[model samples]
Target chain A: MNYPWPDIGTPLDQVATPMPVIDEDRLAANIARAQDYLDSHGKAFRPHIKTHKIAAIAHRQVEAGAIGINCQKVTEAEVFAAAGFDDILITYNILGAAKLARLKALNGRVPKLSVVADSETTVNGLDATFDADRPLTVLVECDTGGRRCGVQTPDAAAALAQRIAAAPGLRFAGLLTYPAAGGAAEVEAFIVGTMALLAEQGIDCPVRSNGGSPDLFSAHLVPSATEHRAGTYVYNDRSMVRAGHCTADDLAMHILATVVSRPAPDRAVLDCGSKALTSDLLGFTDYGAIEGYEGARIVSLSEEHAVVDLGGCAAGFPGIGAMVKVVPNHTCVVTNLFDRMVFHRDGIVTRVETVDARGTVW
Target chain B: MNYPWPDIGTPLDQVATPMPVIDEDRLAANIARAQDYLDSHGKAFRPHIKTHKIAAIAHRQVEAGAIGINCQKVTEAEVFAAAGFDDILITYNILGAAKLARLKALNGRVPKLSVVADSETTVNGLDATFDADRPLTVLVECDTGGRRCGVQTPDAAAALAQRIAAAPGLRFAGLLTYPAAGGAAEVEAFIVGTMALLAEQGIDCPVRSNGGSPDLFSAHLVPSATEHRAGTYVYNDRSMVRAGHCTADDLAMHILATVVSRPAPDRAVLDCGSKALTSDLLGFTDYGAIEGYEGARIVSLSEEHAVVDLGGCAAGFPGIGAMVKVVPNHTCVVTNLFDRMVFHRDGIVTRVETVDARGTVW
Candidate 1:
């Protein structure tokens, strides 16, 4: 599997198509902007590495003033930990013996490790794997209208936090919520109610984590949050653009695809399909947005072909062998599709980095 | 990145969840049935390797009477060629210099290599890459109705065939079409009209390749077809079952996921998210079908969480830490999401094969 790696300064057309190309300038601007916003709000920014899944990018984020990295799985956190990141927070209910063992090993390797638990079973699992010698911080995840993966009410969150504190080897860290976008007030209320219950139980809550890239700018509105976690804000996508979180110029990642087939006047197919661009619609009507083709719409996708309807384009469709850049609907899922991505500066290849934490879902 | 590979005879519960498992018996039956259908129709079966992307399974298809394997990309074909497969058909309009060079090298390694071309640019590109000493066969792709990638009309198909025949170092093999399923009449008419036009130009059409998994059993209805290509029929999925192509019992691939969180009585989230199960809707209302949970529907997916509404289950909802099997909406795309899959017999692990061409999309 010897792929053709482009030269240090080779242009994009000279390289391969249907591959991810990260704009270095755009990446730096995005990182600085997000960090600046959080810093001005007097909150800690713990960026989620699950979006980029690259150790180099994670290191850069940390160097740019990120407090730590947030991972959704133990294996993903392990990759960043092995890459020399000392502080990590895994935001999932990790279960099973195989994973618990890995979590224990990861806890030993990192100086600070935090996990989330919304149920008693998950708290017990974490307690069984760790002890006072190697304490593991557990955060109670509250469902603030996200309708997924969290306790239903504030009372449930306080109860879980109390259980974590009662269990040996487990320290109740704080409250975390991945609330629905535009639900900042709900998150604030949820955090306040949960902290009140914790106060009555004589428990001290140190951290309040609120996360979502869509409402990142409004994070300050939630007064109870001390830390914010986000992944997609680093590389805004078509969904982010539509949500008004970022504009097209802020998109750092794009799929460089060649127009391989022009079957008819209205139809042109690109080499990038589900395997390259991903199928996460993310509420977008189309799969992606072509840079210059304002009117073009990606109608459908097979396993290896992305069929674009060129009838809507104001400019004529591209000819065969012409390369085009596509902004995928979801950047995080697109990052997981490829094993490696090329970072470019002004269309010149600079470096190629592997997605180290990709496919480590367990 | 050392993953936990289950030992031989390891139970499903002992292995990590959210991984693909292939049932050996069902796989064998699927292969036998599809091959039998094509054999009885007097058509050569060239199973597409894009579905499984494993050399071991491609070898089994060849052993079960497949003439060759159909690949969607040159890099994918190279993986099969390195694994001792000599005859291959890459059903993509390969463009760009980097890819053409790789194609030439692959042609030199394989005894028989054919590709599809619907435009003159593709034909000339193929001609420029090889000479008469190392000729390449080209198939004129006809747009019968699939509307993805092919020449618009039979006249265009014949014209492209004529151009391919006149080009040096290229031989016009025959006519090919990836028509809409149940489009036997359209395929027959397109092939007949193209053959008539080619005959007027004093040309011979040797192979007529018709492909689709849904209408595989109806392949014989199109008498002009000499060969049929299909990939998903070997590992039927939710889409195939909904298409009336196969039953749930015919499905051979299933994702083994663990119920990691029970946020509420009506909602249970599995570890298999879009990263593991894929977000390919494929016209299905739900993401996947949970075995024995007749009423359950996968409501949504995050990067590491598959939130399923468990209110519809006839059987009781799976408790936290419970292992469940899920049949994905599109099995082929789901196969590309994983690096390796476990093969099992009667719930016992037998072999674990890497998806050799998993991300070889050039």
Candidate 2:
């Protein structure tokens, strides 16, 4: 609640174990890398705000050449909108009266409000919500490879987009899809195929957008995609390292964790666990990595502590009151868990930003 | 983020859709069942507050005859302290200067601040920060089948407890262990075994606590356990249902989500995913059940949308612009993701409490 406690009283140092420490300089560099990539690609960067879920970072991103911010939920968009982002894109399939109500409310505030929808049923809902007076711009999402959402066939995509246009309150804006890593070719084919289908039906498709940090480098090859969304470039994590996007040293955010117990000679305990780091079951076995702790994998996670299991090879970890910077498996969820994060630049405390939309779980 | 955003400003009917909705009445019943079990067992119910992370709920738990609240982090304990909780037991291996500084700050507020450590390394850290005057309480955490933190042998437990007592500013309280479900015999043996060693060493043992929700129903069989810390009883989840702790209806919390997309004829998508409900990395395949969809499993989850593999059962689902409820595998992690949650009695919404210590990453 009342963070950093006021007591914990003064400041902390490298020895100050167990608090998320963001190396601001590294964060800036991570941000610059994303900017440089987008700049090189000549693509509009509407980074997903859901990743960092920090208004401060979002503002910095906008300043660094992002066209706007894309959020996964209306609540997140609303939080960002309230924090003074004029242009916001909700990169989610909007549905229902509740979602429409929030969208209407948000639409009144922000200058540009764009949303993506996959099905005709969602289009009808949008039609009912927006009517002829305020025509809602709808984008048909295609499930190129990630069989999560969107129509499969190009004909289905065209039909869905035309159906949205046929609705009194909804108009076909373009095509939108979120492809998985190494999905640029697939996304390009889907967009091209869907656009050709729409053109054959005498319907025009303008905006084509697709994005993910791992694929951002290859995004330039997809000429039809005018907009790109990437979230993790600002705070590169261990996954980014594994993905070959960045080196481990390039990561900006690191969980400054405290070692509580070395139960065995090998197992060193840290105060961060699923509760803090989040159990984002991201198809992984670990929550994070304790820097310098070799052969140690975060084997188990309780709500409080991450049980680091070191089989055979053991090192004398930072004794009892030792603090180690842990680079979480994923940085986005970790940032979303906190209300405020203290920034550090060049090993000196810079500033703290309130994660204004830390939790808008609906 | 202002939640419950409708597509067209229509309020949702609480009963219209299926989800893992928490019935306040059911929650009361569940709490009653737990307290009744502890009362029948003559054990103090010091609920592990990690499940709820809400101070109001914790206070309500205390009002319902709880001896105190058992927290796992100094941050969690600080929240309870701020809420005017006098005595709090942090059942965690607290470490580092930053955390100890926080504990020292908490010591000034809460009268009784007890923690557990299984090793001399951990106890020594306690001795370092305790300021000597505060007199922090420590307990030996013995491994009693959970295979997590804790000393492996009772002899080691006694040795650690002695080391804790001998360490300046640390007062050895008793023995603590988190037993695997129905592992009371192991807990009893450890406590008795450790106590005998303590007596042989001219030591006095007072409190002996064993905690874990699944074992609450059968905890008293461990004759040496005086208190129990059970968190999930406050808000049972889908995992608890699968674990035989509660019925599906006994769950006290649900993600209020809107059906944003109908990606396929059979598959419908909801707006809540790993971000809202949390990807708790549960062993189960289903994210949660679609409230009323008989045998419908949410087979896949992305960051935002959960692709419900409807199995050619589209006719059973609600229209596109509809709201639906879904139960998450783990409720505790989901609760930790939010700052405040609106409570409802019947269908009418009521109060909102700041999840006072929702996201304490440290």
Best by DockQ: 1
Worst 10 residues of 2 chain B by lDDT: B3-12
Per-candidate DockQ values are 0.83, 0.56
Summarize candidate 2's per-residue lDDT along A189-290 as a digit string, tens digits: 889998898888888787888878877777788888998888887787888887787898888888877767777776767777787677654566677777
Q: Which lDDT tens digits does candidate 1 get at residues B249-311?
A: 999999999998888888999999999888999888678989988799998998889989988
Question: What TM-scores do the predictions have?
Answer: 0.99, 0.92
Native contact recovery (fnat) for each candidate is: 0.83, 0.71
- The local distance difference test score of model 2 is 0.76
Compared with the true structure, what per-residue lDDT tens digits does model 2 show for residues B129-225? 8857778888888888887778989889988888887877888889988886436777888889999999999888889988877787878788788
lDDT string for model 1 (A1-362, tens) is 88666667888878787888899999999999999999999999999998899999988889989999999988788889899999999999999889999899988999999999988889888888899998999899889989888898899999888899998899898999998743888999999999999999999999999998987888999999999999999988999989899998999999988998888888889999999988899888788999989889998988789999988973587898898899999889888878887889998999988889878887
Q: What Cα-based lDDT does every candidate model obtain?
A: 0.89, 0.76
